[model samples]
Target chain A: MSRVSTLLARETALAWGKGGGPMVAVGFYAGVATLLPLAVGSEPERLAAIAPGAAWVALALAALLSLDRLFERDYEDGSLDLLTLSPVPLEIICAIKCLAQWLATGLPLALAAPVAAIALGASPQLSGLVVACALLGGLAFSFMGGIGAALSLGARRGGLLTAVIVLPLFVPPVIFGGGALASLEAGLPWSAGFALLGAYAAAAVALGPLAMAAACRNALS
Target chain B: MIPEVSIQSLALSRGGRQLFSRLILKLSPGEAIALIGRNGAGKTSLLRAIAGLINPDEGEIAFGGVEPAEAREAIHLLGHLDGLKSSRTARDELAFWTGFGGGAPAAVEAAAARLELIPLLDLEVRRLSAGQRRRLALARLLAAPRPLWLLDEPLSPLDAEWRGRFGEIMGEHLATGGMILAAVHDPLPLATRTVEVGR
Candidate 1:
């Protein structure tokens, strides 16, 4: 296998193995999804009305749960140093790590969102749209959150700092995703919002790694 | 052949305090330089600067034969942190590095055997003791052959036998035209020269 594939494989394995970040994020997402019904009474109309919003919020928070670990673990363990020394550019490594985070945490959360949305009384017809939006939005979150994660490395309270930094970046995705889902529910043309969200995700994937690579270099220095 | 490393007036400062300045050193193939210093003396910092993990505040580090962009590929840095993932088995960890480093799988296996890590290869890295972890990390020095080895406090956690074994490995690496720069309090048998940092 090639170097990039080998790195992706290693990261995927780490994220899928026992006690991995994906499990924690998924569990947190499930917990948040389950609690929305309790906090706001189970009126079908009310639940259905808020289903998409709640799911999006939960997804954002869950993704945040794992962002802190992105570069922190490798940084703490000296792997980042070796990684920097390797032939591959640090930007490529950062991109691979973000991609792995998307696959491990984002993909599963996206797949599980429909179930949560349905449980919250979302119209069954919108389930497909919910999944699609979640997948795209999750990609944005993973890549953008990577910037925060990398920036906060070596900070005294790095995890909390990551959340503080990442939550703001989550706004664009949340608005775009929630708007797309809401438009679809209202029988309105939702392509515009969905397209905007897709554009944000694409931009994130293209640019997040550059910022992350710079952060990693600064932290190492 | 491995290139010679030259550092001229290399200096580093942290937290607004100057650790050292006007530092100069020259190392050729097959020579080992042991960096000795007190705590807070920047021994680790010096090693890191040479590895290109950190940029020096002043002056230059030139590789006689390699391009600056390619210098990192020729340097192996073993800091205090072992870099092993605790959750992964030793075999998988080694395999991932072997693949990533573009080294031969056969060489990784040989390195593992040399470090007496064969028994622990199937075990999770978290299960291994500190000495074992250090040895496993050292295995990377062998897994991928690099001209310059930057090792920091490599002997603190090892038992006498492993230490002796490590000395032998160092001897072999040096014989093959590899250079080592290590931060150490205790003397190493293979270190031909000692540089005192922050003195």
Candidate 2:
């Protein structure tokens, strides 16, 4: 295998094996979805009215569940140090890590997002769009979240710092994705929001690794 | 190619404290330098700087003709952390590193055999003792042939028997024209010229 594949496979395995994999993130999504109906009085119309929005927000938070550990574990275990010596550049490595985090964490959350949205009483037809939005938004979350993970390396309460740094970056995607879902339910135009979401995800995927690699190097130094 | 690592006027500081300055050294092929100094003497920092993990406050580190930023590929630093993932088996760790470091998979088994780690390879790293982890980390050096080794207390956790074993491997590495620069308080198992830090 090439070095990139080897590192990618190793990182995916680490993310999948360590910290309960997507089970925790999926469960967090479920909990948030469960509470929405209770908090909003359990009426089917009331739940359905809020379901898409509630589910979208829940998916965003659930994605955050695994972001902190995306790079912190490697940083803690000295894997980050050794990785600096790899034939692959650090930017590529960071990109691979975020990609792995998505496979291990974001993909599962994406799959669950529509399920939770439907279970919370969203229009069943909206499932496809919700899943699509979740998928793209999850990619954005993973890549942007990587920037926070790398930036928070070696800090006290690093996870909290990561959350603080990543949460604001997440707002744009959440708005774009959730707007698509909301507009779809309201019988309004939704393609613009979906396209915007895709654009954000693409941009994040392209550029987040640069910042992540820089942060990682700074932390290592 | 001699593959010498030369450091001239190397200096570094952390926070507000200057660790060391005006440090100069050279490691020709087949030589070893033991970095000896008191605690807080910047031994590890010097090793890191030489590895290109940190910038020297005031100096130049040339890895023969290799590009300065790319010099880390020619160097391996075995620091205090073993760098093995706790959840992964020793075999997996070695295999991943062997391939990631651009070596063949066969080298993992070969290095495990050399370090007498064949028995421990199947075990998750968390289950292994510190000494076993150290041995696993050492396997990387054998499996992936970097020329300059920056070892920090490489022998602190090993028994005398394993220490001697490590010495034999160091001899073999040097015989192949590799260089070693270790930060250590315990005497290295191999012959080495001492380089003091923070004096």
Candidate 3:
């Protein structure tokens, strides 16, 4: 497990360095957060109300934007086949890859949220909750996105196809995530929202790998 | 030692296209076989099936008399794209793969030198020419310690000198009692049996 994790980390780090897409993704998130304040004027109440949703939305988009490269590059380069042939189970590989994706893209976005939230006039408490939700929700998004990424491997216009297949599935997390933040901001019991987000992440963790492995088999077929 | 690979009545399909129908082949220690076929003839597909990268719609494949998942540690496959990650330096790529294969660092370095990739070790694979990339891919064969080798179009993009050198490597592998099944368009300079993949 440690070996696989190490490999996954190395691969993800290499990927983050090689492609401008991840940087662009982080930049785009920060850019969108920065721009929201300018567009909506200096109204703190309005900014706080929209901040949580905006942050979650940005993270979701970032996760989606970077997903197509997950398996596509390796598939094109034939390294994916080597991965499949490795002694490890495909499920373990999928888990590690998803972990790596979350670490590289999702985790950074989560860590950056408090600053982005501050820009959007969110209270520190609300910002922290938003970050937690985004971390859980973003992991779920990447887990599900991996299935789409593997499915679209080697297809014509694969990037667009991946987005099309994956974006609709993002709706649940986005809704639950935004609703969770809304409840938090309203001082209502927000555990339900957190529970839902946790459930979604758990479900993704349980089933995402199988779906990814099946998609990989189909793509290779 | 266990025989490197054994296959019995392997059937595979892609998108309802029958790639192979009830194919049976076995590769034992010190054996070398060439998979010959025209383009789209399922040569690469067969190699992929053997490597366990693609599951057959029907039938089974085994390495060392065990399922691919069970015997994966003993098998090494070089598929159509050479399995080289272009974004990484040659040294980093080799280091990662050798580590994955649990190979020694010294052995991998020596293999890189033999493949004449020592100078380009720090160069990213994407910056290397096609032949250079092929050489790097071949170097992987030397780095890892595995009993069974499955190569798809191993000779693609190699110049004559490298081609001869690759043949020598293959010969040396056979002499060391390693088993190889390589798909090639041209004949290799070695005593090799032939398997016509597409009929």
- Which candidate number maximizes TM-score? 2
Sorting all predicted structures by lDDT, with the top scorer first, yields: 1, 2, 3
Chain A superposition TM-score per model: 0.97, 0.98, 0.92
Cα lDDT tens digits for candidate 3, A89-199: 778787778777887788778878778877787778887787888889988988998988988988999999999999987888888888888898888988888889889
**Candidate 1 lDDT, A17-59, residue by residue in tens:** 6366677888899999999989999889999999988999999
Cα error, candidate 2, residue B139 (Å) = 0.3
Computed on alpha carbons, the lDDT of every model, listed in order, comes to 0.90, 0.90, 0.81
* Model 2 C-alpha lDDT versus the unseen true structure: 0.90
Docking class of 2: high
Model 3 interface DockQ: 0.60
Give lDDT tens digits, candidate 2, residues A74-163.
888888889987768999999999999899888898888888998999999899999899999999999999999999999999989999
Every candidate's chain B TM-score? 0.97, 0.97, 0.93
Q: What DockQ does model 2 achieve? A: 0.82
Native contact fraction, candidates in order: 0.87, 0.79, 0.65
Better of 2 and 3 by DockQ: 2
CA lDDT, candidate 3, residue B53: 65
Is 2 or 3 the stronger prediction by lDDT?
2
